[model samples]
Target: MLLPLRRALLLGLATVLGQIVWMRLATGQVAWVQVAILVGVTAALGTVFALNFTIGHLRAAREEVKRLGVNEERVRVARDMHDILGHSLSTMTVQLGLTRRILETSGDAALAAGRIAELEATARTALSDVRATVSGYRALSLDSELAGARMALSAGGVRVELPAATDAVRPELREVFGYVVREAVTNVLRHSDAELCTVRLGPAWVEVTDNGSAAGGAEAGNGLTGLAERLAAVSGTLEHGPVPGGGFRVAARGPTAALDPAPSKEGEPI
Candidate 1:
């Protein structure tokens, strides 16, 4: 906020000082007209400086809002984790206590053994969930991604069209597609002012098209650049261009072998 104002002030002061020196050198005396011109120039520069300052302040405020939103999401995730694990651990502890009590009371070895097995399974399941969450390697399901895209577009009041059964995309291709979908949705939310968004998946290609203004000169942010790198990693290609009728389209393609099957409840094989 202050940076732009400071810069403008410095520029205006320099300009005014230069003009004063030039006038002193060129003329014997400083006239009232020169004084009025200097005052007017200073006022105009100050107004421009104020306008630039306001823009900077607004940008800072927007960034602060985004930061606050991210913080809120983190808090919500932590609370959910605490609730889930707390309950699971409490139940497991109770089961263990019961098993111990049975062993001491009746020496019922068979029942105690079964209870111990149950406890072990529960603990293992909880551990698996925690590991999955921490690893951040979520299984990418094409169907789920399509559904999510549909929901997002609908919520944005944009109509969506999807094609029929697409082939089982390769594991690597699926991951890349996941990133493409994410970036496309983000662009729609942030930049597009469209009445419709379309997602099409074919045997060897996936495309996202929106009926919004073209984003030709817009700068690609880190998210899109990172996604492009991911695609490049698998020898896949990503392309963005303007559509004939209007708006923009993003397409990504790669070998089908890149897609992986959904992980089983038993978890990934070691």
Candidate 2:
């Protein structure tokens, strides 16, 4: 790469040469004023060349930065999709297996038919969720997640205790709380064979607790790691570990005060 000074000097030299040739042809000889004019034109060309070169580099640098930012967002979107679909697919797999077993073992047609219907319903719901994820505007609500958790746990043969409504929970915190519920319930479906699961929502916090050994395990997969990152972005906190006696628990807390009380108390991700 040519240094700015060297490039400038070359530009100035070229301009001086062209000016000299023109002056010599136009006038019989070089006048003092012509010499001064040549110097002025040379400086102007040099300065202009240097400035143009600098601007070009600056534009290239800006484009590179923009590309990097876009790439980063793509990575985040990919991670979110993996986490969402992983849990949903796992639940559907379990439901399908149950339906197949019922068909093979149950002598009663009605019982088998019921199980098949459930399986079909679960599959359709999963398909809709996948579509929402693809649209990139999925806004998981605390209410929806709680109801989903109850239905999913029941399907998995786990007893679930969930609140009817989380009206007390601040609106600003609902979405993140919903996310907490989703990942926690997903873990229960995919990894736990627990008999009981419970979800509780508070003013600024939500907790998912289960009486399953898988929750007590020390593994933190991409789902949990990503969950932690999401919480951090909202100035929230996540805690997941084994319950003191049995099973495991996951909890998240939002900001102490409204994120922006003047508006909605909810702020964009940091």
Give the alpha carbon lDDT tens digit for every residue of 1-270 in model 1.
135666866876787777777778888555658767877877786788778878999999999999999886675445334433543464465567778888899999999998788778767855765666555443545675566566555545578786555465555576568657656765765577777887766544567777898574156665556556667778776677666667777777675423523222222211
Off by over 4 Å in 1: 1-134, 214-217, 255-270
Q: State which candidate has the highest TM-score.
A: 2
Q: Candidate 2 on 14-112: residue-level lDDT in tens? A: 767777787789976767686687788767776787789889999999999999999877867776686667766766777777777777777667876
Give the TM-scores of the predictions, in the order they appear: 0.44, 0.73
lDDT of each: 0.64, 0.75
Give the Cα error of residue 135 in candidate 1, in Å: 2.1
lDDT of 2 at 59: 100
